[model samples]
Target: MPGHELRYDVNCSILFTELPLLERPAAARAAGFDAVEFWWPFAEAVPPASQVEAFLAALSDADVQLVGLNFFAGDMPGGDRGVVSWPTRSAEFRENVELVAMIGAATGCRSFNALYGNRIPDIHPGTQEETAVANLAFAASAVARIGGTVLVEAVSGPQPYPLRTATDAVAVLDQLLVERDIRNLAFLADLYHLTVNGDDVPKVLTEYADRIGHVQIADAPGRHQPGTGEIDLDGQLGQLERAGYRGWVGLEYLPSGPSAESFDWLPRHRRGGGADQTNEGDG
Candidate 1:
């Protein structure tokens, strides 16, 4: 089978944690990556202007593109998947949307990942779904000004996240399209999460390729670099490529050792896409 070369980017939020938040971009650049993605960087929904400036300046200094970003998911370190469905935090999520749009405008980053909040016990599932739909629509509309696409991802792990499968996430996207006619919403195909959740990986790539706005990968069993786990990351990515999905593939894995040394499985030359396509299958 013919192999398709995909563009790669580092998820600085996870890959370069050895350095301070503002310094990770340069670290990624030093490691031979031209593009990077990140989760919400600030503790609050809206950070101070100085902090925002510093964050942008770091990216500028390093000359790395911010290819992907997450909206304020509300205490991610504290195990909050997202607050899109949390009725009390609706206002906070909206504030984060504006900030996200501003960052997108400045960085030329058009892909935004919006994690659906976990289910609330006291809240009716219907009500939470309604809240999620409204918030997602609002986010999609805000980012649309910058020619952006809002991404909905199927997250794995122990959280009661409502969308645990590609079908589940797409159902929400379909709802958005039918109810609000929102065309800017798309699915974020995180291969590790989908696999961990027991969804048929090839089936999803075949069925939802056209709807995928972004792709993220980490080896399963443990979210580490590609070759360390049993997943055939290369083959699955090839399937995605053949299905006509041409988008950035984010390296969102934890390093088995030091962050810089974890990329041995992927050659430096193939880190950024261009005429150099050698050693494509080493991963």
Candidate 2:
């Protein structure tokens, strides 16, 4: 096996149908996946903390890894896109770190993806970068203690926010990680966003290959599965392989149907071992 890891997001269906957290792993496993990824698991209102253990245990029993958790949504209290630099909410950043750390540990996650809170309409672009770097540095150190790492993602161009380029994300993340001397931090290369932001992804992947800790995929326009969009999935996958990328490649796309419907687009038979082909669309 090539050692590549593929995981799908719970939001791809669970959030849409209001399914329980514990049902996600089996649902994904049934969909031909051996792992799962999701936005902040802590943001969900159901499955009180006591049930977290059982949910994670189910994934383990099913031979699945809960690979990725997303941006700290808790910062929404400061503003919809909560970056640490929001003037009135230094405490929000601290709270997000603690809350996210707990969520990562509970699910046995090894990676967390950080997004710069949506770029405020009137804020200067440089200001957002400064805030994001500071916040990432603070948050990185915090998650490191829990055995999980942070992977900063570049927001898509069509999306609001000044930090819309992969170069922007990589520059800031690199500077912050180096300054803080944190080896646990890295970049999350999402081809969907990279294309949306007009980034030369393969070039970036080649240059900063060492800093890329995670990878994500989805087709363009609607952010659907790889086979349904304009992004060059084969080229990007090949680029990562050529660059020596050995980490997990998260299936972070909206399924055209239930996730199983998108399996043919994944590199299931590559270096990564083959997934057990089984019941693929029951939650």
Best by lDDT: 1
- Candidate 1 regions with alpha-carbon error over 4 angstroms: 1-4, 273-283
Pairs in steric clash, model 1: none
Q: Estimate every model's Cα lDDT from 0 to 1.
A: 0.87, 0.64
lDDT for residue 185 in candidate 1, whole number 0-100: 88
Candidate 2: C-alpha RMSD to true structure equals 5.9
Task: List the RMSD of every prediction in angstroms.
Answer: 3.9, 5.9
TM-score of 2: 0.78
Off by over 4 Å in 2: 1-21, 44-48, 51-63, 74-82, 121-130, 267-283
Count clashes in each candidate, considering only residues at least 3 apart in sequence or on different chains. 0, 5
Give candidate 1's error at residue 114 in angstroms: 0.7
- Tens-digit lDDT string for candidate 2 (69-108): 7655543334454455454455566666776777677656
lDDT of 1 by residue, 1-283 (tens): 1234577889998988988999999998888888889999889999899999999999999888888899999888888999998889999999999999999999878888898999989999999999999999999999989888999999999989989999999999999999999999889999999999999998998898888888899998899999889888888989988876667889999999999999887788777652132212111
Q: TM-score per candidate, in order?
A: 0.95, 0.78
